[model samples]
Target: MKLTTKELMEIIPHRQPFLLVDTIEELEPGVRAVGHKCVTYNEPFFAGHFPGEPVMPGVLQIEALAQTGAAAILSLPENKGKTAYFGGIRQAKFRQKVVPGDVLTLEVELIKVKGPVGIGRAVAKNQKQQVTAAAELTFMIG
Candidate 1:
């Protein structure tokens, strides 16, 4: 299923300027999700991240992955109204720079889950399908 930004807000707790994912192109409730983020020079971070050369921060890429994972999990009926807090990040790698005009494809699949905690395998790719960032994310539902 696809989820618009408005419908996504109902499942995930995030707002603009912080909310990274612009759209969820694919979803399987609690299993996985594929999201998109259109990187633009207008992003607040670009103003200070670099004066002349603006690149999307690696941390924000991971956050986008986490948000995608959160949306996947929180969309479940049992997880409605719940919040997913980052428990940890492991083996994160940045392969390329994401710049203005790039469309980031964020993908996350739940690898494990028990009670209120879970782990997800995530990756972010650029328009050319080149890996831009990747990580294993752990989360706790609250």
Candidate 2:
């Protein structure tokens, strides 16, 4: 299923400026999700990340993937209204720079889910399919 930003707000708590995902292209409950975020020069972080050569931070990329994972769980009726928090991250890798004008494609797959805690593997890639970052993330839903 696909979800718009407005419907996404009903699940995830992030708001403008902090909400990185603009839309969900696909979602499979208890499995995986694909989301998109358009990075523009007008972003607030562009000013400080660097003036001439602005690059989206690797940490933020991972966070965006995690946020998508959270949305995946929250979109499910069984997990609605739950707050997902970062639990852990492993095997994180940053392969390329993500800059303004890049359209980020976030992919997150659930690894495990036990009660309110879950583990997922996520990756962020640019439009060219160059991976910007990836990690194994654990989240607690409460």
Candidate 3:
């Protein structure tokens, strides 16, 4: 199912300036999720990341992917009201620069899950479908 930003706030405990995902294009409960983020020139990070050359921070891209993954896990009935925390990151890679006016598409799939711990494969792409970053993320449900 698709979820808007307002609906996402219910499942993901993130607020503006930090709530990177704008909407979930698809969701499979604890399996996977595809989401989006619209990058704008006004993003606070742009000012310091570079005076005139603004690039979406690689960490934020991964976090966006993680948030998408969280939506998948947290949307499950059993996980309702629970919080998902980052346990670790692995195999992270940045392939391209993400700048203003780009609509970042994020996809994350749960590859393994045991009890309150889980691992997910995630990737972020720009509007042109160019991968901006990718990584394996581990999470702890609390």
Candidate 4:
């Protein structure tokens, strides 16, 4: 199922300047999800990330993907009303620079969920499907 930013706001606690996801295109409990983050030159971070050349930070890409995964898990009845906080990251790698006008596609797949903890693999790509970053993220639900 797909969710707009408003619906996503209800599922994830992140707010403006931090809520990287613009919309969720696909979602499947304990499985996978696809979300979007549209990069614009007007973004606050762009002003300082670099004076003339603004590149979306790699960590933000990972966070964007992780947020998508959190949304998927949070959508479940068992996780509703709870928060998913980042526990750790593994094998994170940045492959390219993400700049203004780029639509970041975040794809995540749940690897395991036990108790209040979950692990997942996530990747961020551009409109052309070129991977910009990827990582294994651990989340602690509360």
Candidate 5:
């Protein structure tokens, strides 16, 4: 199923300038999710990320992927109302720069979930479908 920003908010607690994922294009509860973010020059981070040339931080890209993963896990009937935290990150790679006007596509698939801890494989692509970032993320539900 697909989820709008509003509906996504009901599952994950991120908001405002921190809510990186704009929409969930696809979701398979506890399995996988695909989210999108429309990058714009007006993003608060652009103001200080750089002076004349702004680049979306690599860390934020990872967070966006985590958020997509979080939405998938949190949307599950058993995980509703819980919060997901970053437990660890591995094999993270930033392959390209992400700038304004780029629509970031984040895809995450849960590889393992046991009790309150989980791991997901995540990848992010730019509007051109070029991989911008990728990583294996660990999450802790609370």
Candidate 6:
């Protein structure tokens, strides 16, 4: 299913300036999600991150990934109204710089789930299909 920004807000609690994913292109409720983040020079982080050479923070990319993962797990009927908290991050790697005018394709897949905890595999890629960052994210639902 496809989700607009407003619909995304229903599944994930985030707002402008902090809401990273603009749209969800694909999703499988409690399993996986593919989303997008369009990078622009107007982003507030760009100003402090660098004066002239701005790059999206690696941490933000990871957060975007987590949010996308949240969309998947939290969409479940049993999970609605719940929040996901970061439990851990594993094997995170930044492969390239994400700059202005780039549309980031974020893909997150649920790898395992047990009780209120789960793990997801996430990756962010640019328009050219080059991986920008990747990591295994662990989260706990509450």
The TM-score between candidate 2 and the true structure equals 0.97
The lDDT values for all models are 0.96, 0.91, 0.96, 0.92, 0.97, 0.96
Off by over 4 Å in 5: none
Worst 10 residues of 2 by lDDT: 74-83
**TM-score versus the correct structure, for each prediction:** 0.99, 0.97, 0.98, 0.98, 0.99, 0.98
Tens-place lDDT digits, model 4, residues 1-142: 9999999999999999899999999999768889999999988888989988999988889889989999989999878888999999999999989999999999999998988888999999999999999999999998
* Runs off by more than 4 Å, candidate 2: none
Q: Compare candidates 4 and 6 on lDDT and give the better one.
A: 6
Looking at model 5, report the run of 10 residues with the lowest lDDT sum.
42-51
10 residues in a row with least lDDT, candidate 6: 11-20
lDDT of 4 at 138: 97
Q: What does candidate 5's lDDT look like per residue over 1-142, in tens digits?
A: 9999999999999999799999999999999999999999999999989989999999999999999999999999989999999999999999999999999999999999999999999999998999999999999999
Write one digit per residue (lDDT tens) for candidate 1, span 1-142: 9999999999999998899999999999989999999998899999998889998899999999999999999999999999999999999999999999999999999999999999999999999999999999999999
Positional deviation of 9 in candidate 5, in angstroms? 0.4
Q: Global lDDT for candidate 6?
A: 0.96
Which pairs clash in the backbone of model 3?
A: none
Error at 29, model 1, angstroms: 0.7
lDDT of 2 by residue, 83-103 (tens): 789999999999999999999
- Quote the positional error of residue 69 for candidate 2 in Å: 0.3
Candidate 6 residues 83-104, lDDT tens each? 9999999999999999999999
Model 6 misplaced regions, further than 4 Å? none
For model 4, state the Cα shift of residue 42 in Å.
1.0
